[model samples]
Target: MALHVSLIDFLSVIPRLYPNDPDYFCSLCLLSTSSLCPECQHTHSTHSCPIGGLCDTHRFHIHCLFNLYVMLNMP
Candidate 1:
């Protein structure tokens, strides 16, 4: 499914939760991004779900992400 928001929208929400020093793994997906999810989509911010928290960085809407995860049998 296409995302409702753009990469910029995702980036706008990330910096505050993570360090913005341009040398950290993307907080949103455990990837390399100074400020953006590796797979950008409007997802739960790091506050709502940390790296090891429920619904972590999977970037679909909560319900949608859950459904996809189930469909794919992902952890």
Candidate 2:
């Protein structure tokens, strides 16, 4: 069985998965936050994606991942 998640839900859960890691930064935008970017200037809320396989050392903005997904899926 596979878990299916919407981008919003996936982003929402990323921060919660690493609640105590203050030094955690997004590998893409390189921003650190316990729950979303404090200085995010985008109209929509930002989320995070863990890179390097479930480790806090690497992460990327959810939007970045979404864009990458779109590009990769483009035909």
Off by over 4 Å in 2: 20-56, 61-75
Candidate 2, residue 9: how far the Cα is off, in Å: 0.8
Per-residue alpha-carbon lDDT of candidate 1 for residues 1-75, written as tens digits (9 for 90 to 100): 444454455446544555544344433356423233343343346456433222233233344434434544432
lDDT of 1 at 23: 45
lDDT of 2 by residue, 1-75 (tens): 234556667556656665436465444445444334223333223324333222344434444556644554555
Clash pairs detected, candidate 1 = none
Give per-residue lDDT, candidate 1, residue 29.
54
Clashing pairs in model 2, backbone N/Cα/C closer than 3 A = 27-59
Provide the TM-score for each candidate, comma-separated: 0.22, 0.31
* TM-score, candidate number 1: 0.22
